[model samples]
Target chain A: MAKNGNDKSRHIIQFIWTLITNAYLIGFIRGKIYQGKIKNICVPGLNCYSCPGAAASCPIGALQAVIGSYEYKFSFYIAGFFIIIGTLMGRFVCGYLCPFGLFQDILNKIPLKIKINTFRFDRALRYLKYIVLIVFVVIMPLLITDIIGQGFPWFCKIICPAGTLEGGLPLVILNDSLKSAVGLLYGWKCFILILLIVFSVIIYRPFCKYVCPLGAIYSLFNPISVFKYQIDKDKCVECKKCASVCKMGCNPTVNPNSLECIRCGKCKSVCPKDAIECVSFNKRKTN
Target chain B: MKNNKSRIITVSMLLIGVLFLSAGILRGENIIIFEKAINICLECIGIG
Candidate 1:
């Protein structure tokens, strides 16, 4: 199938945004991280704070840090960032802004063994991200504290393939000291990252579909986000073209605002009758 | 009526976000983010 122009544009935007957000070139060269005022601001996607070129904090990482900190139990800044961004675009951030999403997109483009459009237990597995959000991102950071009452970023330490791929590998590769310090945890994370990379080649966005806590958080706002999918029932012919084209397994005609829908516009692009449109919540009635 | 309700909800959420953000800034939470982000996160890099 020919690539849609809009899809092409989205890929460009994703690439450009990834570069813009991770624009600290000096850090990559010197094997050091960017320590600047911009670091105080959290990025909208899953870019790692430990990424040498990253100039902004990751929302998940910052959230975990604040929740884990003995001195501070909650962070209004992080909460507010999530609310504002989620309400504005929901998983649109996953579609267009996330660096790891871009990575998966690129990896999926590689011609590999037969692609599995949907795997066994796909329906049930989608709920795993929510579990990860509650347990790893929220509970672990809040409940499990050290002797000094400091909590650890359990998700980052334990399950975040983005952290492993973006922060762990690059820093370890660049720093000899880090290479020597690598242990079982690093190996475990690397194994998880490799598994995800392999799965992403076959199943599109396996992490976002089943593992990303951030995606789970943003998805809660999909039904109410200002920007959302709207189908023209009048123009629709009940063709399942949109569903077939949807990598996220959403039926745009039936439930355009499914939490699984990333607002990636693949469904819109492939709709033959021009029935699909991404409309704001306020303008929904007019359409 | 539904549209009005949605608009109200959206506006309310935005206001709440603004309020939370203002409170966070007032409490110097951004400084904490800055401090944490400035350092090398050993756990994040799998070195912790």
Candidate 2:
């Protein structure tokens, strides 16, 4: 699996966009969040709404908030917004736009060569994210609520390493009051985040593959999203070179459009036969 | 036959997505999202 020639500059766009979306690093200097109109609209990633550097709302947290609000039901607006993102881009957002995914990519780049690529193990674990999406994100919030019609956002409060990383660490470290008040739950989330950070270095995008409710949701639209990662079977020589470069361990030759694929195009970049390419919407690609 | 059926289904799904987006705009989802986002979510960050 020779590296792609463009790999040198391939991630620059992701890097730049990651920084730009999180560009409110100025707030970190002042120890206050950006309170503005832009925070109302959702950004299509796992960025924490509480991150002082954040300019927009997190879709997952917003979804949970709407559900746990006095309404205690699905927000047609949130559902509709997500459906639009899902149909338009699918996990391409995970591939290119998500700060959390970029964080995983950066951690994986930290010279730790441990790879967890046993076929069945990887495939089996992908289902866990779907379970998280259904049970933690959807079911629990709707089913359980306090007297005031507020329910805990189970995934964001308990499981989201993104929140623990982007929002929790920053808020606690910056604010003396918050730091002094850290409790068992904070410690617990810190433990989960540390474990995830370590695993992200060893295993590619373990959270996205195994636990992210957003990833689970986006995956449902991958097969039908406007953007497509297509393989021309006519040109594919069955060399399986594409899988070698795939962080998600997909055989892009056989399953270029697999649900687990983030559509990162690392495989497309590495394809020796020029077999793989991303075909956009509005045209039928027979791959 | 298969491709046509798939196209029809995907088109319908996309149309529904459009409807959802419209509903979001009409219902002022931005206001709801803004309120949740502007506040420092103590519980979300694992605080009480």
Candidate 3:
């Protein structure tokens, strides 16, 4: 009973953070972006800084913007923020903070049966996010410049569904003059966002699992982060229940902090001995 | 040795993160962070 209760509360916490991060509700209604000093800081999740409702900027997008512009030096602030958060908590941001992850969780809760990905295929696709992190967010932004020495923010322009959903869709819908600005690129991004939404309904966080460069970066810190998944071997009964409940397909008994493990704590309740936990300095963290 | 190595790396990362985080505020130009933050960046809005 306590386990189910804890899960409910965890869901509530994640939902609350989602609301907090996207809390500029009036931004959507007014169709204007939030322009405040708070916008300078990067939120730890995949929330788009340009989202009409966003109270803060995105680190990855900020990094790309710095890299693409000839006027500014490379971003220490953006990179540092990511590294700081990544080293402290790893992908806990994905589990508890990401609005898109919440979106996926809500979609997965629909009546249709969920699809579990095959291990081989899942492993193969996991590398794609890293490639995207390097190619779109890093290389393309720095290398491909126009006459003014400004390169494109490839990921935001070409692939990031978050930007399209949070920033583009609402702005275009609300503003009349912006409609004339719409072109083929907007159509391409809309198509991509639609596909990702459809997949989220069937698959467990397809974007976080296979396409999010931010997740790719954070996963690097999972093994080294102060807050981490710790297994108490003495308490283990060797039951596979933890693995069974994992939507991201991580085997908790083997590697609890797998790259794809969003640290959602679904596996913790399934552990009969309470062998699995996310802990720091020997103290368990309440999600 | 492995544990020591990871601790070393962790400490190093923390130090660097602190440096980088502060660098923007102290030594860097505002154009880098604000240019993106202040504007309704076209790319971020899914526009070309």
User: Candidate 1 or 2, higher TM-score?
Assistant: 1
Write one digit per residue (lDDT tens) for candidate 3, span A87-162: 8888988888888778877877676765655556887898999999999999899889999998888999999999
Chain B TM-score, all predictions listed: 0.95, 0.81, 0.62
Candidate 3: segments with Cα more than 4 A from true spot: A1-4, A281-287, B1-8
- Give all TM-scores, in the order shown: 0.97, 0.93, 0.93
Measured against the true chain A, the candidates' chain A TM-scores are 0.97, 0.94, 0.94
Best candidate (score: DockQ):
1
DockQ (CA atoms), all models: 0.82, 0.64, 0.57
The better candidate by DockQ, 2 or 3, is 2
C-alpha local distance difference test of each model: 0.91, 0.81, 0.82
Which one is best on lDDT? 1
N/CA/C clash count, model 1 = 0
Cα lDDT of model 1 by residue, A1-287, tens digit: 43478788999999999999999978887888999899989999999999999989999999998888887888898999999999999999999999999999999999987898887899999999999999999899999999999999999999998888888998999999999999999999999999999999999999999999999999999998999888788899999989988999989888999999888888888888888887877564454
Candidate 2 residues A1-287, lDDT tens each? Answer: 34644544546767887777778888787767788889878888888888889888889998988887775376777788778888888888888889899888888878855767555677787898988898888888787888987877888888888888888898998999999989999999999999998998888888899998898888888888878877777888988778876778778777767888888877877778898877765355453
Candidate 3 docking DockQ: 0.57
